[model samples]
Target: MAWYHSYFKGLPQVAWKLHQDEEYTDFEVDFLRDVLELKKGNQVLDILSGYGRHALPLAEAGCKMTCIDISAEYCDELSNAKTKRKLPVEVLCGDVLETDFGQGKFDAAYCLGNSLSFFPRADMLRFFTKIAGSVKPGGHVALHTENLAESILPNFQARNWMPVGDDIYYLAENEYRPEEGCIEAQQTFISGSEKVTHTVYQYIYTLAEISAMLESVGLKVVGTFGNLEADPFVLGDEQLYLVAVRK
Candidate 1:
């Protein structure tokens, strides 16, 4: 099984819940709204929509939302929330690569929270092709990631430890393979007396490579930003937020 198939459950989920910040989500949603030129009745797709952080807010604002995620646990939570709120949101739980997003179905789509780095070259190309095909001509797609080659390589750390929430302590030991253009990481989460470890991989791509891939899929690169505030993307900016329009 892929590392992500099991990595996002249990303790990692708990850590993610604690890491949630409403302010940050609002900022990102605002950025998405502006970049995508979203309207109240527009249909939007949230790829790998973990727990509906951005999906929920966008749905509340009256956009129709279709969220696809791999984690059943997160999907259940999002479904229950949607039920309670009576939002126009549809939740689909499965591997994104295998799921059909449908052609020309959405006005806009987004893959956020560094989820774009999960796939290697070939799979990444397939994923972008799916996104390109899913949106209508002139529709927009937004991608967010912190694993860009320029950003990560300049600040590469072999090992790092940080606190997650109040009780969980997290550590990551990373090994960068230049030949494969990926980072293999062993991540450990410790809370109270319980501890768990998982291995994850994030494929790195240069900005030029990413632009080329999107172009190859018939998506033209439109805007690139370093943050939600619309700052220009600079080398070592730590985040890449790219917007593209389908041709």
Candidate 2:
């Protein structure tokens, strides 16, 4: 299996452990709703939905959600959450690159948390194309990730450690390979004397490159932001948040 496949296969537990802040979750969900213009009963497709952080909130907000993840474990967890909460969510376990989203089946779709740039350029383009095929004409697409600007910055910190709670912390190490148009990271999670590590191979996409790919897939750029707060994307911004409309 590829590094990402192996890494994410069992990542639901660790990822959930680190991202349990309800306040931030609410804020992000609100941001997504605004970015996608989510309406009650609107059909939404969430690619790489993981344990359904965003999908659950969207579902609760009245959108019909189809959440997909590469990890069966995560998808099962999402399925349980849907049942427990009685939310309108469909959970599927499959590779996003290979999954079929029926033509014009959704009103909007999104791939957030740096999920868009995981594959090589060609594959990434195909992914966008597939996403376009799933959404109706003029539907929305939102993408959130750290942009190439920060990755190529001179003062970029390649390694960092952060505590999620009293007994849990994560160490992340990044290696930028511009020639290969990717950044590699090894993430180590330490929780109560137990340590788990995962490797991520992310292909870096510049704003222009990503824009072109979306356009090629018939998704036109509509808005750009630096964060969930909706600040305009500019140099030195912490990350990239783009909103596009299917054309």
Candidate 3:
């Protein structure tokens, strides 16, 4: 595995430390249900459901969820949470690229938290095709991610820091490669006197590029939002919340 591939594999505490905002989680889950039209007992697929942040809440909302993640620790956390809460949640530990849930298997599906960009650009189409094959005809799919346009902005900040907790901070530096259509980032976690840094790469796709890719895989673009509350998508928005339906 590459140095960045398993960067988040086993550290649930660290993951939570970086993304512990309950309001953000609730907003995402709300958008998933509202936009996807998911209801109680509906079958949903959550790709890269790290630590069940979204899956557990979706299960709580009465959805039968199948969550897949490469992180064994995250899957274990999900399994334990499901068992403890008696929620209809199935945790699958495997690579998203290799997993096959069969065609027309789900009513709704989602890949949130910028997970879609983790794969190389060469595999982008295959990834979307796989997702299209997993959902039933007319089923909805939602993807929340950082807008690629942001990377190309004239005033894009290459480095930034986010305070995580008392005496702890998360630092990030982004380097965009226009020729390769990807971003290589160096991320550092500083907690009191301890600090760790990791480098990772992610492909950046424009809204048009992503829409075309999804369409090529039989997923018709239905809606685009700038936020979780369903605001219309516009240029300069840092995030993109795209909703599509299987044809």
Candidate 4:
């Protein structure tokens, strides 16, 4: 099984919850709304939508949301939240690569939270093609990642440690392989008496490569930003947020 198949369970999930900031989510959602020109009742797809952070809010705002996630734990949480809030959210648990996203079904689609790095070159192309075919003509697609080659290379760190919450401590040891154009990370999560370690892999793509791949899938690049505020992207900006339109 892939490392990502089991990476989101246990302490990692707790760490993610603790690390998330509501204010940041608000900023990101607003950016997405503007970039996608989303309106009430528009159908939206949230790729790898972990726990529906963006989906729930968009659904509450009157947009129809379809969220696909690989983790059943996250899908359950999202489903419970949808039930409690009575939101227009449909949560599907499965590998996004294999999931059938019908053609021309959605008005807009987004993959955020740095999830684009999960796939290698071929899989990335496949995912982009799926997304392009899933959205209507003139529809928009948005993506976010911090693993771009220009962003990570200049400031790469071999190891780092940080605290996620009062109880959870996290450490990451990263190894960059130029040949593979990927980062292999061994992450350790600790919370009180419990501890776990997992190996994570993220592919590194340059901006040119990513834009070309999106274009190859009939998604034309429109905007590239460094943050939710819509600043123009530059090298070593720590994040890449892209907006594309389906041709």
Candidate 5:
């Protein structure tokens, strides 16, 4: 898994070709700007903030941003971006699972793009413990995860890839094994004249499981939406977006 290990090491250019799509970025930005209700003067922490794609813009909007990541490469890249834009952002290289931060440090916290899928239950518990300790009392945390009830992966052969920019492409091809609760996929990217690929294995979680995780960390699931727009969720049509309040 050295390739997976290198995920934070500057994104291998192929990742940009694979994932830096307008649809993908637009979807995320809409959520951050609209669903998360990002505003000026708010202090926020982004767990697993990838390459400052989300944090940098928030900084530009007059918020102080703290980004923690598992990749040193990404930390450095974020630092470089901070210097370029002079954004008020602090980038830390550490395991999101157990990063130590003082209580009430942030006005809000967020984890997006199904990053938790990379961890199993115990590890997710550790991350939540730290996050619960990181946010201020009554602060909020937004978590974005796939709504498996709406996923359309009916068969393994229903795989496809779409290009992003001139180089990157994203592949969402896989099948969910109900009993196993995992979606298996081959994600491929051709970046900067190099080919990068990964066999991505992810566990699917129900809305109930997501709520349970939040409750376990002393957070309450106040809202659950079907998409980034906070629409009434049609369980069989799309992913789940959640907003939880800290107690």
Candidate 6:
């Protein structure tokens, strides 16, 4: 089974809500405009591009983008965005690890929204190698993911619930595995007359771990920050947006 499809399909409503909220932050847009240093006619790849959050804006910016994602729904969302403006965007539905996109095809690349946190440590290293292989020489890559080192991991199982519009959001429990350096989040959303549950597992990588993984993949960490604004990485920053150059 395709992991991304299964994970995202179960998360449509929340993901849609995250993008739809009026005061929502369009970090993708900020990255394209500010962090990515995108030049005119840059060929870019949005690895795990979800729901056109990053794809549409880059296309509108006159970028020739190859949007890669495993979710058909998200891929269609990109198509719909292009149709809305009669723009051209190549949206491909496939796995990032298996897709034969050809090495050094893109001028630059980006992976945002904590998309890189889905894999285990070794797979994450492999992911970096794959991304580096896809990037052309002198090109760069911007990766966005949670700063797991700053994440507040509770010591015991705790139940928490909140409301998101019409849905009652609930985290049934969460546990931190210190030895494994991972956090397990089990959650459920109750909306109207239905309830759906899903578990989100992620590794809590320290700054050192991330740096090492990049180096192991032959990518040099050019810069590391807490956000798209290039804010200095502080002791408690929750976002890690790393910029790297292919070696």
Tell me each candidate's TM-score. 0.98, 0.91, 0.92, 0.98, 0.81, 0.88
Candidate 3, which ten residues in sequence have the lowest lDDT sum?
Answer: 9-18
Model 3, span 45-125: residue lDDT tens? 998888888899999989999999887777887899999999999888888778877678999999987776777766788
Best-to-worst ranking by TM-score: 1, 4, 3, 2, 6, 5
Provide the global lDDT of candidate 3 against the true structure. Answer: 0.82
Clashes of each: 0, 0, 0, 0, 7, 0
TM-score result, candidate 3: 0.92
Quick one: best lDDT, which candidate? Answer: 1
Off by over 4 Å in 4: none
Error of 5 at 219 (Å): 1.0
* lDDT per model vs. reference: 0.94, 0.82, 0.82, 0.93, 0.71, 0.73
Off by over 4 Å in 1: none
Residue pairs in candidate 1 whose N, alpha carbon or C atoms collide under 3 angstroms: none
Better-scoring candidate (TM-score), 4 or 6: 4
Please, what are the lDDT tens digits per residue for candidate 6 over residues 1-247?
4234476665444644454443234655766556567877889888888776666767787888888888877788778888888766888887787787768998888887677667778778878888989988878888877636764442233566666655555446777778877767776776667677777676778778888888887778888887666787765777777888878
| lDDT score, candidate 6, position 63 | 82
- CA deviation > 4 Å runs, candidate 6: 1-5, 10-16, 19-27, 153-157
Candidate 2: clashing pairs of residues: none
Q: Write the per-residue lDDT of candidate 1 for residues 57-166, one digit (tens) a residue.
A: 99999999999999999999999999999999999999998998788999999999888889999999999999999999999999999999989999899999989888
What does candidate 5 score on TM? Answer: 0.81
Per-residue lDDT tens digits for candidate 5, residues 1-247, read 4234555444443364245555666577667666556678989998888677778877888889999887776778889999999899988887765567567888888887657566556666777778888888788888876534444343234478877766565666677667867667777666567666667767666667767987988888888877766786565645666788788
